[model samples]
Target: MNTKIAIIGAGPAGLMLSHLLAQKGIDSVILERRSQKDIEETVRAGVLEQGTIELMRSVGLEERMNQIGYKHEGINIQFNQERHRIDFPSLTNQEVMVYPQHEVIKDLLNARQKEGASIYFEVEEVELFDIESKTPSVEFTQYGERYSIHCDYIAGCDGFHGPSRKAIPSEQLKEYEHTYDHGWLGILAETAPASEELVYTHHPNGFALLSTRTPTLQRFYLQVDRTDHIDNWSDERIWEELRTRVDLGNGPELQEGRITSKNIVAMKSYVCETMHYGSLFLAGDAAHIVPPTGAKGMNLAMSDVQVLAQGLIEYYQDNREELLNSYEAIALRRVWKAQRFSAFMTKLLHPEQGASPYELRLQESELDYLVSSKAAQQSLAENYTGLPIEWEKGKKDTILS
Candidate 1:
């Protein structure tokens, strides 16, 4: 019933936070509403930043990922049926790994289990009490029995829909959000990847992306009306649209296969300027969300928890409160930068819902400038590979609460 920290949700942010804390000799309990099998089976795209990849290795959780994850040096940006490649290593000296988020969960969960850490799954009706006080508690049900967890601190890594955020008093929190008019219809199929690197397409029809999950499993996405339903897209129609949107003479031809999963995800940019509200500190999707256009989703979540872990470590190890006090400010800086890049990519690729012909040409002109200018390409490569994060551990003399 009592722990040092009570973490809600077993997703990457929660699990990674616990793992990082454990490595620093802290104790935490994890609570999840979904079953372990469910979380592990849900397939979500992960484009790991260089920092994230190194962080996983630092905490002894890189065995499986290093063995199975795909690495890429850059990505292709296509517009007006012409393709341009941005080389990340040469431009930014970084690379990304294509490892799905479920794999990260599995790795972190397995690491916790091996260390005798406790994670309670399938919990229901979770509620937070005294989140603004030093003595916070999490209440929920499991297997038809009510239970509670009392901890010195509470982490709201439970995501946007979880009780953690809702528990925050609305008067003390400020939220900024922008929901796009279009969404991505994504699929996982058994087929060869359309290219060695990820392909981002800007077409007259809509935006499309080609990504890889495995040697033979390809993940792809297409922009569609936000109101569109999965029922409107058959496997054949989905393939046709993808082919049409991504078609360019410079890239590989479309390869169709048997799709195993399909879903529609709306594009949205959200930021909770208040990541720390008293004893409850939010991370990952609980604090911010970026559209998938920039492949920043999982990477941003990992970084959020990284900063949280460091802050907690400083507090418990040295009794310093500065890092913890400045959690919201530090996390928000990068969150907004990510939102900028994601928004730029979304707006640059997805044509306006109703735009004049001149407005449409302006989008293509920007792409033309990007492809022709090394300075612009370098900027894209830098942002795409990842912006600088505070990778070093320990506190700085400059951080102001």
Candidate 2:
């Protein structure tokens, strides 16, 4: 085969896969429909799991991340006007870093250029051919011309919108899905972060999270009704609502900016079984998607690529297909674990209107238990900081490369 792999989507999953495959002397091309400028301008997913940080370090993408990323020791849970801190390091012996997806993409793009690999930006018409056939290749368009890259294998790193899922016969795939009634309206500000650690507040009005991207940049989100449009909230209105939801007695004063971006992101989780057919393999959101509540999107994507990279490396070195066949099962186990965690965290902190009084009290009790019990705190700490990634040799401190 002329190409070892073809990865669609230049997001974290595709880029990371390209980087790792290159390390193993495997050649691959990344095709992304969006321009580099468009990707950098989009804001999403800032928190990084301890496992993800370690993985980036192993793959030579952590120096800049370590220098600029914000390190968070724990998260503060605010409920009933009382604030409780869950010390992540104290309980789990690990910490999370606040780094945006955009920055990660920026670093990956720079690194790929240095390596001179093929990452075509603004490409279109990405398709999967003979996915179930013994030989599979990707067909795409560049510069108004058609092209087909024959590959030994294809890694569908493209996200939820990519062609990986479509390539699978509808009758052969069963997609399970769940959508919540609430969504998040995120905002980025040029002001200093309000608190050192992310604050998740449960208020009668809604939910709020105070997070950061850099020392001088603050990123925050407000939980609102799924039907609530961003048009309903003006800059001043957003500030007023934020004040009401987060008033942590002595929390950092919020400085409002241009309301730089606003959108309602509905929460949902979906997974398709059997992520591979013949020579085609699926990775990241192309195979499964989880809500962003636990900041698991990027982390899980990296995890997916990690497993695939190892499997492909083994295959190239020794013609072993054992790990490759087990890839879907291994990745799905971790994926479901994170999905449950994210769903649990989202509902635990997000207040639902019209909920029974007893249910509301139970939510309070859950919060109280989390703060007052070491066992509960430890559970949150371990998951928050990220449990040791499961690798073939054994669990490791980091899973970067």
User: After superposing candidate 1, which stretches have Cα over 4 Å from the reference?
Assistant: 249-252, 390-401
Query: Which regions in candidate 2 have their CA more than 4 angstroms from the true location?
Result: 250-252, 391-401
Tens-place lDDT per residue, model 1, 269-305, is 8998888988999998988889999889888887788
Prediction 2 TM-score vs. true: 0.95
What local lDDT score does residue 312 receive in model 1, on the 0 to 100 scale?
A: 91
For each candidate in turn, the TM-score is 0.96, 0.95
Q: What is the per-residue lDDT of model 2 for residues 55-135, given as tens digits with 9 covering 90 to 100?
A: 788788998898888888999998987778998877888999988899899888899989998878888888888877757
> Against the true structure, what is every candidate's RMSD?
2.6, 1.9
Work out candidate 2's RMSD over C-alphas. Answer: 1.9
lDDT of 1 at 127: 94
Compared to the true structure, candidate 1 yields what TM-score?
0.96
Pairs that clash in candidate 2: 55-400
